[model samples]
Target: MKSFITGASGYLGQRLAIKLAENGEKVHALIRNPKAVKTLEHPNIKFFFGDVLDNISIKTAMEGCETVFHVAALARVWTKNSDDFYKINVGGTSNVIRISQELNVSKFILTSSTGTIGPSLNLPNNEETPRWSSFNNDYEISKSLADTELLKHAANGFPGLIVMPSRIFGPGIASPSSGVNRIIIGFIKKGFAVIPKQSGVIGNYGFIEDIINGHILARDKGAIGEKYILGGENKTLGELFEAIKNRVNKNGLVLKIPVWPLSYYSLFSQFLADRFGIEPRITPDLVKRLGQNSAFDCSKAISQLGYRITPFEETIETTIRFLSQSEDR
Candidate 1:
């Protein structure tokens, strides 16, 4: 099998590509940066430089591939320009769908997010749960729009499957650079002494390997136009931090600050970060999102795709070990 993966240099995409290669599939990765090409160098993997916005680029990279994994997106909480977010997340997704249909690719897998579903009030969120209008940030909005568009295309006879992963917590093949990774690193470095009070939100955490396995199973058994939630066990922020603290054998101070004050602080921090052209350590949107529960249920994926997730504690230990080794090096 020949597989094409967008965002191949990303945490999830890179791991998925390597796993596919290990499974005896030829992998072609679409990368935007020349420097990223070196990261994907493997015997069964080839890199193609392209942007998802350019149809020609996507088409060229997708040529002769039986499966296409659309994993690229503008994942950010605070962006001054919503246009960039929409252009990359929604518009880019549309292009991928169109090209996959035009190329007659047998399977097109979308690496969507549980953010599209938002917080569940009465019950655990399933794929059939109705999306809430209160999606916090531009990133979530764009992903929701993209997921809606993909569903529309699927209804029109496009062969597509969506895999919605919760908070991904396992170590990546490359270095850690995402929000989750930052939290882990901060805790390890004793930077996260104060635990915010408004963090009652239960985030579902999944290991990257389990998520990739879920994607592969979805490709093999998922019905066209169907969506699956490949979520792991859900836990609160405090519980998560405690787990990490136990694993690292350290006791970090925990303070519970109200959401309103933190939100204001996040806004100021974001403003400063934007002025300096740096990503903020915290954003207002993120602060607000942390106050809402983001739990999900993956029973459908479990029954249909045979999806199994590692325990959250186990994933945390593995991530800390990987980070410790990298730090030692």
Candidate 2:
């Protein structure tokens, strides 16, 4: 398949593109930075440098593509600029749907988030979970809105499938820069006497390879206009950190702290961000998510798309090895 992917330089998108290229498929990736685009080294991989806001750029990149993977989005829990989230997530998604329809592409896969199912503390959320009015952050709100829009069009005969992956982590080529990787590395490397222990929330973090494979299955078997969540092992923050610590063969304290402090830090960080252009490392939204059950039932993906996920311990070990090697480079 001649595939066209947006956000091809991102953590998931880059891995998806490389997998396709390695399999001898022609791939065209839309990346805003020419420098990042240069990293896709496969002979079958090509790139276009432009923002999703520019229809001309998307059109140019998507031309002659049989399958369209609309992976681009402004993925941030906290941001100095919130408007970009709406623009990139909602507006950019609209452009991709419009162009894919114009071209009559066979498959248009949308990479959404399990956050669209909204937050839960007891039961695991699923694709059919009703959305709560309260969202985790601007990014969640924007994606939920965009996913709604795409499904609305699907109801009106839009041929698109939405795939939501929860908390991806694995040996990404950009492992050092990936969010989950940072958390794993920081927890081990920092050697803190104790780490924040969050028992309230359950997170379903999947391996990157399984997520990529899930995408292919979704492309082949997913029902039109339906959403499938490719999630992995569900565990609390404390369990997650414990798994990492054990994988690293180290013993550290898992400290349980109140969310109030994280909330306060978010406000302070936002102040610095607003005045000095410093990005907030912690935000109220992030804390809220961390304190909620970000867990999901991927049975839909598993049963419908035949998806399988790697174990958490195995993924952590791979991440550690990749990060250790990256330090040399």
Candidate 3:
């Protein structure tokens, strides 16, 4: 009847909160900034100013809610202090789980990432896929740790499940975690882009609407302690760009660079960041991650949760239109 959501101001969380509210559920949305309430205003949605790290605030907001969606995380490619990743992703997640258990929440969905599944080894990764390599960055490592914590709690009789969504795109807040949407914006607005030389590196791209629906289905039908990969088409970087070009009817200059050279460039970017506090466009760890295959298999979610993926071409066109409209405003 009621739900509590963390990171309600974020791209996915914001959309998820609104979706639940529209579905006639009383939604308590946790956001650190009070100003974000403007965007989330709905008759069924109430704003709770809080952070996931604070037990008192989480407990207060989650009171009387039947479900909790832990959607908050530090998903950036680089942070000045790497500890920030573990602190929020792992620590914040643990706090929420403890509070949820204390409050007797019926369903808990932890929003994990497909990155934790690691790059594809011999095939596209499935829910059972183990990390084939050490984590490429702190974000992945921290999220993986958070997933472990959720599962541990679930095994101990906590009502929790993990939903891992691959690089989500389409209309939503262009947060750092929404990299695919940012890429679409860049190609359409700037008319120029740079990519890894090996453009064939495969990755899974999911539409935002599909991902949101997957979360709802996970809550309704997902098994306790199980992790589901909610994803769409397995596409190469080249194919991704080609789809955008076709949809927009415009050509963008996409220059591909070798990974080694990009690594050197990222080193310089990091140096600039360390010296002047400017955010690096890319980092060495991100480059390494991108060079590997990030594709996934969503058959489990498809079969168990009735998850459906939109056709990639239609999804891209819809995304391009949304981005184009936003730029005009």
Q: Pick the candidate with the highest TM-score.
A: 3
Error of 2 at 253 (Å): 4.5
Number of the top-ranking candidate, with lDDT as the measure? 3
Q: Which stretches of model 3 miss by more than 4 angstroms?
A: none
Error of 1 at 97 (Å): 1.4
By the lDDT metric, which is better: model 2 or model 3?
3
Which regions of candidate 1 are displaced past 4 Å? 173-177, 273-278
lDDT of 2 by residue, 114-185 (tens): 877877656888888787648767888899899988999899888798999888888765632256778766
Residue 31 deviation, candidate 3, in Å? 0.4
Q: After superposition on all CA atoms, what RMSD does each candidate show versus the true structure? A: 1.9, 2.0, 1.2
Between which residue pairs do clashes occur in model 3? none
TM-score of 1: 0.94
Q: Please report, in order, the local distance difference test score of every candidate based on alpha carbons.
A: 0.84, 0.82, 0.91
